[model samples]
Target: MQITKLELHTSCLQQQRKFYHEVLELPIVEENQNSFTVKTGTTALVFSQAPNTSSNPFYHFAFNIPHNQFAAAKAWLASRTMVINTNGKEDYHFEAWNAHAFYFLDPQQNIVEFIARHNLSNESNAPFSSESILSVSEIGLPVRSVSTTCEYLKQNLSINTWQSYEDVFAAMGDENGLFILNYIERPWIPIAATPGIFPTTISLVGDFTEFTLEDAMYKIVPTAK
Candidate 1:
């Protein structure tokens, strides 16, 4: 399923605005005192202010990049910020998935990724920029039961798990986008941080059904034809 918008909570809105707008150079679509929304390719990432008692939610999310510009994108990112190395390697290739990816941390210390899926054929010779970011394609959803969560998504939304391991992790949805259904306390790959469930909502294309799983909700909405 394609994610049209993803709403997440942040303890500090000013910092988020600065990082996404000034630092990353993403365009701000709207804003107010307590929250703001930034355009991320086809998706709108909204960060809202959270209460002091609420722990800042950290997530592992990825952006799809043009396949031909992976090298340039990597170089551009490294020149601007530190890239997180997985097993002492900054760039990673998943042969089975036919994708390349690298990770970094945002201002909130949430793991952010840039990935190129070879199967999609998004190739370009132009210089890579924030605009080259295709979309917020993947989100890590930490839940108590992987099977139950996957089943719920299948039954309610017609979304299926792309890959899985019993009680460990499940990659749900297609290559263009995925919901990383990870078991709670499971450390996210290439990092030491364990997944945590903070408030989040995702609106998917072409479906208007809304449902909650493990306190996080998903809303289906219309997609532009």
Candidate 2:
């Protein structure tokens, strides 16, 4: 489902304004001293003020670009910041998936990634570049419910369920847009974004219409599948 908007809090506005808008190059919805919103597909994620928030309330996400423009996308991002992960890897070539991906850290240290290939969705052989961003590719939400949330997303968002294993529920939608809903217990250990954390992330895939509902309900926790 596309995330229309996500409202969360950040302790530092300067950093928030720069990272999402400047660094990641997402479009801004609105901005003030207290709050800011950035485009994530059809949805805009709004960030407010909060200090040392635990569970992060949000996890990590990815973006999809035209398969052919992988080189140009990487070059553009490299011009801004290092594309290497904290582990200093330049790219993760998934032989199993036939995809090439790279990651970067946001102002809040969220692991943001750019992927060159997606197994699902409308593909373009035209080539990828900064201008070829298809849409927000994947979103991870830290929730307590796995099956319950998956069912709700299936019924309302038209997301196709692919698998639910361990604490991760995998789904796909739109064009090559895949999301992983990470579910875990309430008490989560706050790990550094260096490698990222789990049970505390929500990803917005596809258009922004998915979050327009007043009651954007997602399940919390569910028993092991």
Candidate 3:
């Protein structure tokens, strides 16, 4: 399943504003004192503020670019700042798949990334630019536990796990339309649509058998009912 969009929250408006609109060079479609919108190729990446947010809900997101454009994207990003190498450059290449990419953190320390894969196709090059990302290729979520989170994904979410080592569970899309729920050990807070905070609850929560991220799940201590 392909990712449609991602909504994240941050506390640093000026920092995030500069990073996303200036550094990333995404076109700010909407803006105000509290929030802003940028084109994520085909999907839209909107940032907002949150109140009463939990460290448990914080996360980072990533994308896979065309292999040919891998160097180009990296070059473009480098032209902006050398911070693209915020993550370790030693572990950049995957020996198993020969994929190339890099990672960095937003002002919030949430890991962000861009990767290029040999197995994936570059055929679907739709109308896109650095400002407008096409679609969310991958998503990251921090969870307290992997097995319980995985069971929630497998049962309630219908996501199929491709592999599981220890604390992480990698998965692709099922009929529910999800790709790669990379679970980690950190926590994240949710922001609604305020633009400059980290305590907003969530956006339109809906019920779709197709999985529109309608009900973005949060980890809970199941009751002994």
Q: Which candidate is the best by TM-score?
A: 1
Residue 101 error, candidate 1, Å:
0.4
Q: Kindly provide the TM-score of model 1 when superposed on the true structure, using C-alpha atoms.
A: 0.93
Candidate 1 clashing pairs, residues 3+ apart or interchain: none
User: Residue 87 in candidate 3 has what lDDT?
Assistant: 31
What overall lDDT goes with each candidate model? Answer: 0.84, 0.57, 0.53
Clashes per candidate, residues 3 or more apart or on different chains: 0, 24, 32
Full candidate order by TM-score, most accurate first: 1, 3, 2
**Number of the top-ranking candidate, with lDDT as the measure:** 1
lDDT of 3: 0.53
Question: What lDDT does candidate 1 reach at residue 112?
Answer: 92
TM-score each candidate: 0.93, 0.66, 0.69
Report how far off residue 50 is in candidate 2 (Å).
2.9
Give residue 207's error in model 3 in angstroms.
7.4
Better of 1 and 2 by TM-score: 1
